[model samples]
Target: MEEAEAEEQQRFSHRQRLKAAVHYTVGCLCQEVALDKQVQFSKQTIAAISEVTFRQCENFAKDLEMFARHAKRSTVTTEDVKLLARRSNSLLKYITEKNEEIAQLNLERKAKKKRKPEDENRDFMELDADVVGSDS
Candidate 1:
């Protein structure tokens, strides 16, 4: 039971690290894209990057480097970070895909319910005709 608890803690820690990586990665990318001097950061500088804990900075740097290399980009931009964040993490990707799917399903449901006035009128006319014929 203790072993199981330890494993769970390790798993949770890993997830937290990944989430921190993504957040820090985005913050760095935002700094780059926005060209804001107010936001200064370096991979070695942990205190500057508030999104990630000091211990996680090393891992974040490694992950960010790998992602940058995979993209074959000389500089990491917000778009690249976003793509990396989405691609490297299954949970993030799943959530994003699920959200998009839900949105599409909702749009389809709304479209299906949207009847043209002409079609509605035709149905009403048919019903009226049936009622009159029955009365006769």
Candidate 2:
């Protein structure tokens, strides 16, 4: 029982570590400017916690480093972070627009279907009434 409990705990720890790594990596990639300058974490520190492949992380780090070098800026700012965070809302906006368009199309299709049946029925009823009057 004790061995089983220990194994469970170890598994839980590993999961937690992986979760932390993924969170940190995503945050770093998404907020490169804000973290690179304002945050005081070493590259090794970032690497230790990230689950991302070495190449991906390396590329991300390189881009930020290059930005910093080119801009002659010593610190990453909130503005830098802003660049990454800007993408957060556009995806939701796109989904909402698509949903609205689909709803409109569905409504138009239903209206058209209803009208076709009603128009045909009205014409058929008129023809039947004319035949009855003439026969009488």
Candidate 3:
């Protein structure tokens, strides 16, 4: 009976260590930030946030994998992440706008690259025209 009790205690200690390892430290950081807002966070509040964040991340990973499989792709894309964020309307709007902004930036970068050579040629042509007209 003593041996069984010792083994049970060991298992309990191992489980406690595992739980501590998985506990999100960022939740404590968030709680510290909340203190600045005059909000007092109890242990329960931190635990709840940690638990919810873990569940959310786990669910998002699972959903993203499922989306990749559904699309017959081996890799997940930004669209999959955006789709997952779409569950929250505000989040969906934010992500969509950010994506559009990123797309616009990319287009601008490509245009700038394409224009560089044309701009150089135009400048050279104007210089040549000025030189020839001045000599004439």
Q: How many pairs collide in each candidate, listed in order?
A: 0, 2, 0
lDDT of each: 0.69, 0.70, 0.85
So what's the TM-score on candidate 3?
Answer: 0.65
Model 1: per-residue lDDT, tens digit, 3-101? 999999999999788767766776667577557556655555533545455446666567767777888976655444455467468856775677678
Candidate 3 lDDT over residue span 35-121, tens digit each:
778777777877787777667776888999999999999899889989899879999889889989999999999999999999999
TM-score of structure candidate 1:
0.31
Q: Is candidate 1 or candidate 3 better by lDDT?
A: 3
Q: Taking the tens digit of each residue's C-alpha lDDT, what string does model 2 give over 6-81?
A: 9999999987876677767656674676566675655665565464564555565676666676679977543444
Give the clashing pairs for model 1: none
Best by TM-score: 3
RMSD of each: 16.8, 16.6, 9.0
